[model samples]
Target chain A: MGIPYFPGCTLHVKAKGLDDSTRATLAALGLELTELPEWTCCGTAFPLAQDNYMGMVASARILAKAAKEGDGRLVTVCSFCYNVLKRVNFALKNNDEARTKLNAYLEENYNGELRVLHPLELLRDDLGFDSLKTRVDRKLKGMKVACYYGCMLSRPAKEMEFGEPENPALMEEFVKAVGAEPVDFPYKTKCCGSYQVLNNYDLVAGRVKDILKAARVRDSEVIITSCPLCQFNLDWLQDRFADEDKSFSKIPVLYFTQLLGIALEISVAKLGLDNHYVDPKPLLQAG
Target chain B: MTSEEMTRKVKELSGQNPYLCMQCGLCSASCTGIGVMDLLPRQVMRFLQLGKEEILKNRSIWMCTTCLICTARCPRGIDIARVMEALRTINLRKGNDILAPEDVPAELLAEIPQMALTSGFRKLSA
Candidate 1:
């Protein structure tokens, strides 16, 4: 069965590698991801004002499109997209007043039929870890990976029901399924200062430094995450930080799908492994 | 606006009762943007509870990255992040935006990811 996939705006532009690697990894696991037709951005962030019916309308339009296409489940790789879409879906289903107002604003009656899912959830819950193990062509033996969940993937537990909000292990289990060692760290669920990378790079750089330091202290070889913002902050900011501090060490950040793509024996170039600012090829090859 | 009017507006806009906040510093402690904010997360809530409308002009609300750590850790189950968003909404609705698109250098704009631009504009722009 093909899962309806929503590749948000960023994946199409800055994080094309995530989209490519995700498609390749899912294909290896015998799961087909079909892009939803005419999908718009999931508003990136959920609007929180009580009277912002227009913000809810923006997300409602996307969900209505998914339902109109007859898709029961909508899967996305971006944590921002996952968080916004899931929260909007939860509201449309649980809050009758909000749903009525949103439906009226969008001029379409949506019954909140589409279910939002993260790609990690699909791999962990839908496809068994054993199934993933069977598909791994190259075991990532001795590779110490810090599975960074960032903030959105599992937070505001009531809305995001992926796993344990504070201490999630879905990524760790997925890493182990591909025959790699998962390193437990304190900042696994820490915020990477998110969009502050745009205007306040210094703040994000500081948070990134702390997250990387935690991973290094735990003896992690590389950092793995599912969010593009987290991946960009952790991977791209290291060089900028190293220029300011001589003692700063570099750690390659890889998207979980990219790591899975490597274990599935997909070629490096095919997975865009060389596209990272800090090259992960050396550490990946060492594994 | 009077303090009572500001309190009523915040309560209506956020749908979160500021008075429910017991002045616990958990939200401030968990907030990642504590170093940057002019007022702490708990302070923002306290100002709202005290009906201090001056918080509306504070830059602390804009500094929030909406990480939700404060909301997740709040003992009173107050969605502090949402309150921050509500404050931003109130500010933006006044026809004043925190960022101007043209002021951003084209080169920097070209290099940054779309997620950052989209989310930033959504939060900071009118």
Candidate 2:
């Protein structure tokens, strides 16, 4: 069956590897990702100001497209996009005044019937981890992986009802399903400083340092994440910090789908392992 | 505007009752930007409750990455991140943007992820 996929802005442009790997991984699992027609960005951030109906209009248009095109399920790879789309979906359903105002901006009124889903939710809830285990051809044995949730996928508990907001185990379950050991790290659901990387690199560097330290101390060989922003911050900041901090060790940050692609026996190039700032190829090949 | 007006505006914009905050400091305690923010999360809520209009002008609101750790951990179920974003919106709507897209160096813009650029513009731009 085909699912409506919204690659968002980041995945469509800068994070093609994540988009490619997500498509390949899902295709291997007997699910086809059909891109929604004429979908724009999910406004990147959820406009928290109740008065800003334009942001809701932008997100509502995307949901409208998903409702018109696919099976009323919009799958997103980027956590920021997922959060924005999901929150907007929640508001459009609950707030009548806001919904009426936002609907005025759209050609067809969205009745909040569309469901926004993350790739992790699709794998865990839809595909079932057990089913995924049965298809694993190349087991990631002896691989110590740290599953980073990075806020967006599991935060604002009311909206993102995927798992435990603070300490999600869905990725860990997926790792175990692929036959790899999931490391328990304290900073798994911690924020990676999100968009602060644009202006405040030092603050992000400090947070990334702590996140990586927690994983490394747990003896995790690599880090797996679902968010493009989290992957970019964790991977790119590691390179920036490596020059300043001599004790800093580089850990390969791969999308969870990339790791799943490896366990599914998909080619390394197809998973976009080469596109990562810190090369995951060595550790992935060694596994 | 007076402090009462500011508080009223915040409550209206965020649709969150700041009076519900019990001062448990869970929001402040869980905030990741505590080191950078001049006023912590709990303090930001306190400023809103006390109708301190100056809180809108504080740099603490902009420093927030909207990570929602505070909102997730709030004992009173207050959406502190939304409150913070409301403060930013008030500031931005008043023609006080933290950063302009034209001012950002092309070299730095090219290096950062597209998510950062897009979300930054949404949050920081007027």
CA lDDT scores, all candidates in order: 0.85, 0.85
Candidates, DockQ: 0.72, 0.75
Encode model 1's per-residue lDDT on A1-287: one tens digit a residue: 48889999988878888999998888778778999888888888888888887777777889988876645898889988999999899889998988999888788888777889887778877888988888886558888999999998888788888777788888999999998999888898989988776656567877888999999898899899988888888887788788988998889999999999889888777687877889898876665
Pick out the ten consecutive residues of candidate 2 chain A with the lowest summed lDDT: A197-206
Tell me the spans in candidate 1 whose CA falls farther than 4 Å from its real position. Answer: B103-107
* Model 1 lDDT at residue A214: 97
Quote the positional error of residue B10 for candidate 1 in Å: 0.7
Off by over 4 Å in 2: none
Q: Would candidate 2 be rated incorrect, acceptable, medium or high by CAPRI criteria?
A: medium
lDDT for B27 (candidate 1) = 88
Name the docking class for model 1: medium
Worst 10 residues of 2 chain B by lDDT: B103-112
